[model samples]
Target: MTEVGKTPWHLWVVGGLSLLWNAFPAVDFTLTNLQNDFWLSQYNEEQRAFFLGTAAWANACWALGGFGSFIGSLLLLLRSRHAVPAFLASAIGLAGVSYYQLVQNGETLKRLFGQAPLYTTPVIWAVLLALIFYARAMQARGVLR
Candidate 1:
């Protein structure tokens, strides 16, 4: 009795992690700058300038990375032929992309000269680990073959 196209519990783990790939756009789209409404920032020239510069760069990176992953995931979905390698690559690549964006995001935000928290590395590690383990299990069982 062989299982094909039927993802086990582990694959769900990977799928769940894969969902994180969409988080970038969520944050980018959901965020709302309250400064305009509150009007507390009256003549904060440096902050204003930094905000403008960072906004442009941050938006670009976030948009690109976020949208790019959407496409990448689609491509990844078609990688069923290369199960182990594809899943492994996606697990690794997602983590790498997250880290890469984290750094870029932090740098862009730092222009504000404020304490900017750009999430952490452990989250990516956890997600990637789950995905990797799931992919490994699926491969071992030939479920993804």
Candidate 2:
């Protein structure tokens, strides 16, 4: 059995991997919002246009999803119980962003970006849910305090 108040080995491994996994989205969110020309230039015109024309609310959702998850990973590493709420917030944000992409502008995006989003969005949701559950489990075990 794991000792109370002692950090488990799996926590470090999961937290580290989660941090690395989330970093890309966090960076992408930052660069896209900043409208960094060099970063924006990497995408084709349609892709750039899709990202550039995103609505303000959608951008806010994206920020919460990306940055919230990143913060959650950090909090997890710190053994904070607050990581649960952070991941929950990320889920809310991800839902909003997914709605915007898959429902509000689904046809347009599908035409512009193909079927990749449809496949990938569910995978992202699954990963986020898994993180949330893991954090909760850690908290329940008193690993996160």
Instruction: Choose the strongest candidate by lDDT.
Output: 2
lDDT of 2 by residue, 29-125 (tens): 9998788999899888888889989999999999999999999999999999999999999999999999999999999889988999999999999
* Residue range 1-145, candidate 1, lDDT tens digits: 4456565664544454465664554344334233452342553676555434444545454455444444433333443435445445444454444544456555644554444334444664564455456555555665655
lDDT of each: 0.48, 0.94
- Ten residues in a row with the worst lDDT in model 2? 1-10
| The best candidate in terms of TM-score | 2
TM-score, per-candidate, Cα-based: 0.41, 0.95
Error at 70, model 1, angstroms: 4.8
**Against the correct fold, how does model 2 do in TM-score?**
0.95
- RMSD to native, candidate 1: 6.9
Task: Give each model's clash number.
Answer: 0, 0
Clash list (residue pairs), candidate 1:
none
